[model samples]
Target: MTIKIITPEYVVFEGQVDSILLPGKQGEFQIFKNHAAIVSALVNGQVKIYTDSVPEKYSKYFTKENEAKSAYSFAIRSGVLEFNNDKGIILAE
Candidate 1:
């Protein structure tokens, strides 16, 4: 699935991802390919993006989760998430 993490000033991250773990208002949730469509409010927490390779340009925006760098994370104070048709968009603060 494709994911984009955006803020008022700029796009924090944008690229194809294998999956993502989001901090939903109710709790945490994971999204993968062909997952059901969803729209939810997010809380202050980390957003984990999992991919085999990180794009060089956007790599600076995320902190590598492991030495191999197959996973990365971005923290937010709050945000909203919407996913559909194999794509996810996050409007974050």
Candidate 2:
């Protein structure tokens, strides 16, 4: 799946990802490849990014924890996230 995180000033991140874990208004949830269409409110919290390999350009904004998961994460302000087909987008304030 592909993901993009955008703010009013700039596009924070854009690349292919294996999964995304978001802090939803109701609770935290993970979205995977080919996830069903969804539109949800997000809370200010951590956003996790998982991929087979880290994109070098965006490495500064993420931290790789364990090799098995190849997970990276960064804090996100309040936002809205939408997913459809193989794409997911986050509109952050």
The model with the greatest lDDT is 1
Residue pairs with clashing backbones, model 2: none
Error of 2 at 8 (Å): 2.5
Give per-residue lDDT, candidate 2, residue 76.
78
Scored against the true structure, residue 35 in model 1 reaches a CA lDDT of 98
Per-residue lDDT of 80 in model 2 = 92
Give the alpha carbon lDDT tens digit for every residue of 1-93 in model 1. Answer: 899999998888898999999998889999999999999999999999989867788778789887446889999999999999999999999
Model-by-model lDDT, in order?
A: 0.90, 0.85
Clashing pairs counted in every model: 0, 0
Give the least accurate 10-residue stretch of model 1, judged by summed lDDT. Answer: 60-69
lDDT of 2: 0.85
Instruction: Write the residue-wise lDDT of candidate 2 on 1-93 in tens digits.
Output: 999988887776899988989999889999999889999999988888887766677777777766457788778789999899899889987
For each of the candidates, the C-alpha root-mean-square deviation to the true structure, in angstroms, is 1.5, 1.7
- Which portions of model 1 show Cα errors greater than 4 Å? 67-69
